[model samples]
Target chain A: MMRLDNTEIRIGFFGALAVAALATLPLFSQGYYLSLGVNLMLYAALCTAWSLFSGPTHYISLATAAFFGLGTYTVGLWVDHVSFPLLVLGGGLVAAGLAALVGLATLRLSGVYFVIFTLGLAELVRQIVSWTQTKVSTRMGLYVFTDFTEVHIYWMLLALTVAVFVTGWLIGRSRLGFAMKIIGNDETVARHVGIDTARAKILLFMISGAFIGIAGAISAPRYAYIEPPSAFNPMISFLVVIMALLGGTKRLWGPLVGVIPFTILFDQVSAQFPNHTPIVMGLAFLAIVYLLPDGVTGRLEQLRARMKRPREKLGEEVRA
Target chain B: MQIIVTGILLGGTYALIALGLTLQYGVARIMNLANGETFVAACFIAFWLFTAMQINPLVGLVIIAPAAFAINWAIYSVLLKPLVDRAKNRGMLEVDSILATFGLLFLLQGLMLLAFGGSYFSYTFLAERFMILGNPFGLNRVVAFVAAVVIAVALYWFLYRTRHGTAVRAVAVDPNSAKLVAIDVAKTAAFAFALGGALTACGGALLSTFYTFNASMGVVFTMKALIIVIMGGVGDVRGAVLAALILGITETAVASLIDPGLTIAATYALFIIVLLFRPQGMFGRQTT
Candidate 1:
């Protein structure tokens, strides 16, 4: 137990050090590299936030785009009127509120129904936003001008990523996390065991929504302009799901493992063959599903177990 | 009255679209997200046939349907067979197939975009209007509607009157018991998936006769089809047809009465209400 605790502490220490090191990238790197760092941190935060709820519950929510867009639009609508930090906070709150309402109505649905409902929710929100914007203003897009540089956005995203990781870790150790694991394994059994599955799911989903919203809010200024199509793009949801799955959602840090490589690869592909980006993404998704069902971290764990098993068997033979 | 007539006519083709999705999800146990891409691919082919060879979209269906069937069969056999084989349970298969087909969606969409740039294509094939209840309606739409009805009727007859179709339905109901009764579950699933793909292609070809289409427009049809499938119940043919009309009418009403931009939002609103009130779908019996 002591050794396990010591290992946990060591991991926490090293994780902080690594993030701190990443925070210094803007000092040495400029232009494309700095922007790439920002992109990496943005996705890392989004994927981590997504996995916080979806990882444990086994309920895949594609509503990340909805919440993210709400965050983005919140910033867009109020960039001039509201302070930047206030807008970020308001964006997260708005997203969480929407999540609570949506969760109440749709969390009862299981399996594919839940998945489809969330997917529809994003599209619905986008349409409504588009319609309202059309009615309210002649211009469909809002331009956002802020004094914040790429460095500031990168730092904000990095901080958000760390916060999401820490929160996820804390949740994983809490009773709520224990309940969520039970729900994930078997919701009916969890319900039979007197767990309030709905409440648990809603709470986690709200937290996930809030984090996604904050990430969007932080990244909004970087775009300089926000339109309904780009802000509420479903590709964001797809990428987050693919990344989280690729990392293996079993561990808090798993999504980070997937996000880093995927973001980098996506950047390179889009830069080189912009028209074929979707094709590459599609292929990547198929490869990941077939070859790494358990994800990179999960595959690594299996390899470690296999390696240890042979050594343990040899030791038993020596004893015999 | 005008809205009702137009809605019903539009719904006829929508029913055909939804029917394909129902079969794919019901019998094959694969919720194919690429279903719309098949429709779009057919639309493109139909366009090509019309513009290049002066072939009618109706005649083009003869070529497109069979090719779609062959492609879907190959996809099921090569890509989805391994997934179905390895899946530990229904839920695992659902997740795996959804992810796989989601990838397939992007793949097909990307290919279509590459072949046909991001421009809307609508040929002047029977654009003449005819009177229907004192309202003018496109002749192409009426032809497409009639073709959809014929295909849907033929599908119905096959499912109800044939021995092979009985086995397919049995697999949809319960794959394990169907296997016990000597039905080849895998074979039936492959057939249903291919049939579904063919049906979707047919719908696409017919729609291409009248509807303006682009590569990315496939996802909209997909979402509309998905909404119909769920609202009608996963495997229920009659329910899908009914739900399609409901959707078509509602959308037309919303577009005519309210803002045109709110049509998608209205579809979602209805979907959410149905999901909240009756998760089993309109015609589906409650399962424990």
Candidate 2:
């Protein structure tokens, strides 16, 4: 299992601080900027869920959106009819249930097959939601209230993001993380060493689904609407995955590194060329992959490692 | 029946699309979740060139195939190659591939949306339909079908007959041994990526004629290709065509017989069924 160290502590502390800063930005910034911050935080929380299983366990499952979509619909249905906290809980529960079902069918497959299965899952949920939305009348559809300030929801979601981060950080340094790292490293060797690869993956998979589900639940009411495009998109899952990579999957804040800049760039780009955003961002991602192979946070570690190298070598010489 | 003929013809295009993916996975042992972007990107490219240059759509294949190859090559360099290089250290092949390609997928779709609006648009090309054996079928459909078979057979021959193809096979089997045998792994990988790109474009060309596709076609094509590669078993081009035929036939048959809504569900159900029963795939060899 992988173990967290001082890096995790530093990353977590800073991650929380970033969230705290985002929560207060609304006071100083306009609605659009404040809304962007909220969007970033929401994505951060969702990305955290993605980093949990995909980051540590090293599996490719696109079902993150499926869980997210379910969570959205769950809260969308509940926000008006039920209390806020319970609505959030209901979305999370629905997401978790769906995750469990998906994991049962998916964990048996490995490699690209797992990825394809998850991708299909997202499309399936999206189509279902699209069909459902079509049947309902305008006022009676699944969308929740369209007019609500996301100010309070921002902090709440921030807190949830923190909680989820801590959960993953704690688990990242625990026996389970090590077991997963081992399984991810080599299932054959780990199974030979008596690690229950299937059980560990299933548990991690469900837990991962739960976190994304909870994020979706919170986001649905905050966003004031829920539908297939917003909820079950493959791109949504892709963002979370990329965010996890940018933050350095092994470290705690990979998703944060991925989320913050990506959102800023997206917002700024959409604002600007709005026309060529796809080609520009597509090229940007290409640039990121080609140049910054380690991602943003990963690059941070590289610089740190380089700075530490000469100092350690001098220390060794002095000792000699 | 029109459905049977259409499905089989469409299957040819599907096979071509799956060809690149199968080669990438089988030879490089890299799981590319975003490979379908090549197909959709080509669709947009064809649409743009056709509108911009007024080039004949079939003649436009010359432009789309190589361009797709280049874009896919860049994708390999930008997204997949780095992750592939790090597979040894991260021991996170599956996760890394997912995240990296997930990034690629987003960037591709985002760019597509940004460059081209989300509205569905198609190019109208007139290809007179001739009765095929006294049956009604469009000339374009026949061209697409013929292209699919030729491309599939050509790829099969490339793999079995050509030196580079042999190298690709060698890389797929064992990178270390292939290196020991003097195969340039990087070159072979680049070749595989380019080949995959070209094949996907062929499918995209066919697809552009049949349906109007925007940026969103990538994931859909990726999913359908997934079913093909899985059922076909990853390494062999022949297997891919076989799998595409089965899927194309099965899907069209089901849609013809039942509801179209069942297409995705039935396909996914088949994936689970195959996965539960044969994890190595129908024709894939068991290695790890």
Candidate 3:
């Protein structure tokens, strides 16, 4: 029931326009560019989805790999029986369900405890999946053979990215968003003010989980062969967190700014200095934490405010 | 009986690993994700010394531990001090330290990878069997266990009996009050971090005696140490030892009783259960 600000409408219009432009990318470009576009959109969706919960709440969930892996394995295990679109939906729902369960158990735990639990969740799921595979079948990995080409995957990821952006925008303006803002500021105060902190957190977490799960499902075919280790890699969670933090999670579109550059950089690092990728990634993480703790957008915002202060002071003096 | 004996032996080393983390986290107040890297680095150093110069790991520790102490102290002062100064509160400090140390983790791991290559390295030092209570154990394991216990006892005595150690514990309990009381909170934290790193590296040297290790194995050890720290209650010296033993026994029991693959999963389940029932830790006082 909130009125739309002019800036909000303008931002939305430009966002839609950008998505339209991105959708035509695959039509013009083929091999490397197309693959890179897909990778960009994949992380864009993930970082945005991660920020949806962690940005506001400051919970820092490392469970993206868990949900993403479930979504991946959902497609890997059931592509033979189910349609692709249905599998994607199933993936989101399954991940959301897991998020709800985890949120109920862990939303109360704060600080490092929550962070480690989420990290362990991925390893736990990976272990269970690996063990089950050995027991159920001699095959170590599932093949995700789909007719979908790179172009198809790119456009699908684009759609998912747009969907996540729209969802984030909507949630940002809702009552739930207001509650989350309050909760983020101080959970005890929010509870004192009669806000149901647990419910709000779980709800937002579920939404974030669903989007991430869909992103994973959409990206599964890119691998062709899916295994527990790669699907549930802890590195994915770390990358998403670093990317989102780098861009600054203050705005809905902030993660995209980080996602674009980092994806390209990662691609180059993997290709050229493949052996030193970890070193490069580690350095980047340190630089981000030390130099730009508030992220790129955040630092920019600070600079802007500083720039505007002198002008405002001058105007005040003239008026006096 | 055999399983229990093996678990106890394993748990001794685990206690040392967890103790170092407790010092770093509980006293220094930095959740050092890179703590295990120190351990791994020591292992590699031990391996190199043994293979190249024919030096015993015990002899190697004399050099490596002090080096680790100096390096970690520099790391704290150069990298983490700014973070500590800038943070407005405990939560902010925790977040900054986690991210920063996470970066350090990969940095150290990658350096180790570049230097050591992606190969498992273990040297045959005291690979012979020794009998205890009708159960067979690796002589290396027994030696490592003995070393771990001696180190833990010494650490305990220092914390309880020494003045500087008391200041470190005071800082762990309440930095603000310790500062009010004219204690150098920052200095104590830095010293504790360095000492913790040294101890962790010492544990790694011990582990290198019996356990095969590689560059990437640091995260697993870090995770295990973290679980133990949380289970025993953060900052509680006695609790961490008990928790490490419990974790060691549980993991050993799971591996022997069920599938070995499920050991990590079982560890996760136990951790989640502990987090649910006792978020403050079994031994920690409830704080709000």
Candidate 4:
């Protein structure tokens, strides 16, 4: 077991405190805020789950929506026959299985090819689901009827977000995380150093898919009705990528930092100027990519290091 | 026979679009994710010109091509060049370019959405139909096919027979070696981007004459072009043409033979299979 650093301990403490505070929020808030909290938690979990693989390996998988959609469909098909928790776990396993198959086939390919393959994977899954629905069912969507309240859904999402966050933190402090970082830096060198780069990548890919799948399973019932388009929305994939990048994927808290402000901005902009929301969001993304390529957390780290330099020099001068 | 003819005709436009992508990605090593958006923007330009003025889309192509070339040149010089330079300095050019171009995709799409709302538009330029082998073919489709072939041939000639084309190829092969021969690497890159923009714009203009399209259509077109380019082996023009034909035929066959809803899925499956078996592409040099 790896020992925790001082910063890690403090972060853990504050993180637990934040989760406790958020868990109690539904008690004081009304329906609208509770729903908003649910959306926030959903996206937070997604972004964190995305960073689990793409952040470290820099592969830029565009198949998150594919796995998420698979999980939703898994629950949609079997929600009536199985227990809720069992269905959720089944959803995660299904996504993980698909990810493993895809990762095994495509992980050896580099650069744009890999990105395009992932994009195609999502589109392929969407098409298959749509086709199957048309051929097999009278309706294209499933109506989910449950007695779960708004607060109950909110708690579920919150639990998912916490689970994703802890997984991210643990991975960051693990030996696997070190290997992934090395691979991200340079795959060729990592392989030369005896890293099973492909195996590592495929493993991370499956892990990431499982978490996103669980998030999708937990969030699926909230929709009341789920269809191919809603379940496999490519926009969700893009948003997760943008949020994770904006927060600086190199750190554990990057996705959390990114999802909060961006989700609020998304809600506000869409509510006020629905037609122009894309333009607003697009411009914001452009600005972030150009000016803050390292993301908010990465930039803060730079600033902190810069500030520390003068203090270190002063200490050395006094010693001299 | 009808399906084959139709697929080949449609492949003409796909080839043109893939050619543009090959130039940007294969030759210049810049992954222009907004490639399809450029095509859509040109389509919109033609549509607006036709609707506002009595200008024919064919006539508007003259305006669209040059305008697109200039716009893309400016994008490369201003937005992408700095990022490329920095990535090169840091040795992360491939990944950085992908993200930067992805940003450009969103930027272009958003701007287009703001300018032209989510509505479908088509150029109703030649509404006549002619029968060939007992199959009714649109005059617009025939014209678009002819135009696509002519432009593709011209592009091939330029790349092979012209001095500037040779310089572009030289840079694509080895930038250091090209620079040693006094070839302006940066200028060639810019020119390639401009040419790519022009080709895709021309494709869009031709397609507008036949197909109804909206802003969101850019993403689909981009994916199709990417598939063709990957299949042809990045940067291989001849390979792109062949791959585009194959894809077009496959799509048309699937739509007619099996189910229309399965066309896109079929293409995606082909892409995955290709990546697994031959990631270097059909025409590319062996790398992986």
Candidate 5:
């Protein structure tokens, strides 16, 4: 019953093809290449999951690391007893539950307050986990034994990325997405128009948390050993944010576009100039913010519209 | 009793740091993520002065404060002003300013790291121990505490008694009304930023005498200042001081009573609790 636009159709087709290509990477690629693919997929999935809630609602959450870490620790602690799929689900549920609680309490605060609160929540969670590790386990890190091979992990990550991408696309087209756009543009106006802004925000926040948590859950086994510092590294939150913004948060495909190039950049920078990577990344971030505030996709969209305008004018003149 | 004394003393430094953030947020409505970095930069400056030039750390404040003011003024003029102007033209200033400041944070951190390699540095000056109320306290900490209190008092005086300070307050209270009254809102914002930079730098200079620090420690201090500012309420200077004192005491108490590793977590928990119960802050007026 719904009409699909030309752009949407092309995107859907290309998206499927891209996923198929990625799915075959594990079959052909080995060792470092497969691991690189997994890493790229992991970040792409995170950027997508982050943009799902933050892009539409305009709430810049720094809690991605918190949820991801929760999922990692959940898997780390319980992998022996539970099956892999159930552990993944459990990780998602736990993160969603925490997000729901945190959202209810902090969503009322807007702008910088929300950002700071989320950052604090992440730090708090990290410290608590660290404290627990020291107290209960007497060990600095947790090791999980997984029988899955590198290819299997790659497939799992690819599957998770697909799920996240699909969820993001579906959410973008749904009524909830419509409400979120309104809320992002103007919360007061959205509320006046009979939208329950708080409920919508909390739900979306939970959904975002669940996706990131699941990504963390599946990816945890790859590392074999997880420490609190690495598990809840705040840099993940910052990188995901930068990726989402760089790709153009307005479009569903923006993050993917942003992540591919940045992941490679990150890899190269970390390899060659490890200490200077922060400086390089920081400068790049500033350049993006100052020069391309709307991001790569937004700029491309503007260019397309500009090019189309002259043709449309010619068509009008001919008709006249 | 000793823990209480130490907490209050530590709170003095926090109050000084929070004062700078409070001024920026309250007056200019810029949530400066780089506030702590400004402090760290000043500390590094003082450290360089002390180590490289053999100058006393306290004396370095004379150079540090003015340099900090100029740097911050430049930041506002070059980076923030354009963004703020653009956002104002579009009528969406709040979110844009926040993002811009976030970018500025990374920029500052990166630059600091590049300029001064990541290594822990502390100023070794006036290192002495003295007994106070039957408890040994570091003389350097006592000096830092005293300097913090003096700076806070001076800031309070400036805010209450000076004409420029009144203008800053007026702009903070209502920019449109201040503009209607022929006050230059842009100039006021720049001045506020400069003043905030000086205060934070002074706080950093004082802290350098006592605390061990590195370039990456900026975010942690920034978080602490933010918590204090929020707990004290936006734009309420007195509340910021009170909140800082409360935080210092709470951290000390927690460290002493429980595990030391849990101190930061305890403070974050308190911050969350305050956010949930009193989002406007303890001393801020209610807003719908």
Candidate 6:
């Protein structure tokens, strides 16, 4: 146990270093690539947050976007009225609270039913927004200064993304993270050991929501506008999930590691084909599910595990 | 008097849709969330045959059914077979199939857009329109209703009586054991996928006559199919049929009674309520 804990510490330290280096990407990245890096950090944060609660438990919580939309709407609503930082923080808190309530009820379900309920909830939320808009005046638009380049907002999102990653890493290494992992692998065993399964799940939901919300909040400010479709769409949820799974679910820095390359690939495809963005998304998901079930981070871990084996490993170590 | 008649007309079409979901889930035990994609695919196919080839949409149902079955079988063999272990002790998380097939949904949507454009298409061959009962139901809807009933009955017979159908059922119940019994589990699953595909293609035939459709129609049908599948017990074809009727009526009634915008919400609201009370489903086995 002690040795395992130490290993987590070492890996986590490296992860922190990597995250910090990735966060400062704008300092050196070119204009087009800088935005790509910003997107990478943001989605990585969202996916990692999603993995905290749903990934481990095998719950497949589909409402990960509820908080994201909340965050988006929160920032869109508050940007004109309050400071940007406060709006972002507020988005996080609101998303966290909403997630808490949703997780408290919906997360109690398992498997397909859980996925369906969360989908219905998202649709319900979208419809509610749509319905409310019809009743109200034409002033429902998310007003903002149209000309700002969003560079500052990008930096702000990067910091929050790094902060969330660090915080998630800390929790993931803590006793609580272990408890969640235990529950994730098998709730029956976790219960036998006296881990409060419900509480652990709720904790994950809150953590995930806050991170996703922070992402949405910061992203909305960057765009200077928010809409129902963009905020609540399953596309965003699927993208984050693909990133987390692609990077390696359950790993602290998996999202950051996964999102950067994935974003670069996505940017390249979009740059080349222009209209083939969905094709890339579709192909990315297909490849991840088909060719690499464990994901990139998963592959890395297996390689690491293989390398840790004695004399045979030493002979093969030169391959890397 | 007319509500019941209208409900039955709507129910038949919905039942066919639900049957598509049931066949995949029951036989292969796979949740093909993009089953509606087949419906959309078939619609596009029928449109192509009718417009480009000068064939009537209804007349082409014969070709479309078998063709759709082949397409469905091919997709499973190509895409899904590669993903799954297809061996004993390998029933892992099936969600990957959902994601993979869902990718197909988006891919198909884009393909259809590229090929047919985003505009709605209606078969010019659809000339028959008449009333049923007091309500102004169309003749095409009646044909769809008859087709749905016949297909459901035929499926019931197939599953219960036929050798291949039994093999499919055995695979659903125990894939490994089915493999041991020389049932050719892969072929059975492929057949199940094809059967589901054929069923939706029939829906495509009905759709071309009843209503104009486009690329985006799949989402709504997918949602409605999901609700019907949930409303009906999982893997219960009969239950799915019944639940589809319940849903069709509930949706139609809610739309007529309240705001049309609230109709989708009504089904969801009902589902949320049902989930809280009966998570296994409305017709699933009673709690022990």
Question: Candidate 3's residue-wise lDDT over B1-288, tens digit each?
Answer: 887878888889888878889999999899998988999999989999899999988888798889999999999999999999999888899999998998999999999999988999888999998999877889999988998898899999999999988998999989989999889999999999999999999999999999889998898889889999999999888998988888888889999998888878878877888888887787877786
Tens-digit per-residue lDDT, B1-288, candidate 1: 988888888898889889999999999999898899999998999999999999989989899999999999999999999999999888888889888997898888888888888899989889998898788999998988999999999999999899998998999899999999999999999999999999999999998888889998877888889889989998889989999999999999999999887888888887888888877789899988
Candidate 6 accuracy as TM-score: 0.88
Model 5 stretches with alpha carbons more than 4 Å out: A1-13, A313-320, B88-92
The superposed Cα distance between candidate 3 and the true structure at residue A210, in angstroms, equals: 1.3
- For model 6, what fraction of the real interface contacts is kept? 0.32
lDDT of 6 by residue, B1-288 (tens): 566666677878878878887778767666776777788888888878877898877678889899988888888888887666542223343667767876786777667666776788876553576676545656777777787788789988998899887887888778879888899887888889889888878876777766688875676787778778877876677778888888878877876776667766878877767666776777677755
- Scored by CA lDDT, what does every candidate get? 0.90, 0.75, 0.90, 0.85, 0.86, 0.74
lDDT by residue (tens digit), candidate 5, A1-320: 77899998998899889889888997787988887888888898899899899888777789999999999989999989899899999999999998998888778667567788786677788888888878886789889899988788788878888888778777778888888989988888999999989888999999999999998898888879999888888888888888888898888878888898888888888899877766766766676768878889999999999999999999999999
How do the residues A1-320 of candidate 4 rate in per-residue lDDT, one tens digit apiece? 66888997998899899999999998889677888898898888889899999988777788889989988888888888889999889989999999898887878667566687776677788889889888897888998777777788789888988888888777776778889989988888999999999888898899999998998888778888998888998877878888888898888778788889999988888889887666665666676668888888999999999999999999999999
Residues A137-190 of candidate 2: C-alpha lDDT, one tens digit per residue:
454246577444677767777888888877886777678889988886678899
Candidate 3 has which clashing residue pairs, if any?
Answer: none
Candidate 4 lDDT at A214 equals 90
Off by over 4 Å in 2: A1-34, A78-82, A132-140, A146-148, A169-175, A184-186, A280-284, B30-34, B41-119, B126-135, B161-167, B179-186, B253-263, B285-288
Query: What DockQ do the predictions score, one after another?
Result: 0.73, 0.41, 0.80, 0.63, 0.61, 0.47
Off by over 4 Å in 6: A1-33, A59-61, A78-86, A97-106, A119-121, A145-149, A196-199, A304-310, A313-320, B1-8, B86-91, B124-129, B161-163, B174-186
Per-residue lDDT tens digits of candidate 4, residues B1-288? 888888988899899899999999877788777899999998888888888997888899899999999998999999888877877432367667777777778778888887877898876889899787889999888898898999999998998999998998898788889999999999999999889999999999889988898987787888999999988987888999999988988899899998998988878877877877777889677753
Q: Which run of 10 residues does model 3 chain A get worst, by summed lDDT?
A: A108-117
lDDT of residue B179 for candidate 4: 95
Query: Number of clashing residue pairs in every model?
Result: 0, 11, 0, 0, 0, 0
Q: Is the docking of candidate 2 incorrect, acceptable, medium or high quality?
A: acceptable
Identify the leading candidate in terms of DockQ: 3
DockQ order of candidates, best first?
Answer: 3, 1, 4, 5, 6, 2
- What TM-score fits each model? 0.97, 0.84, 0.97, 0.96, 0.96, 0.88
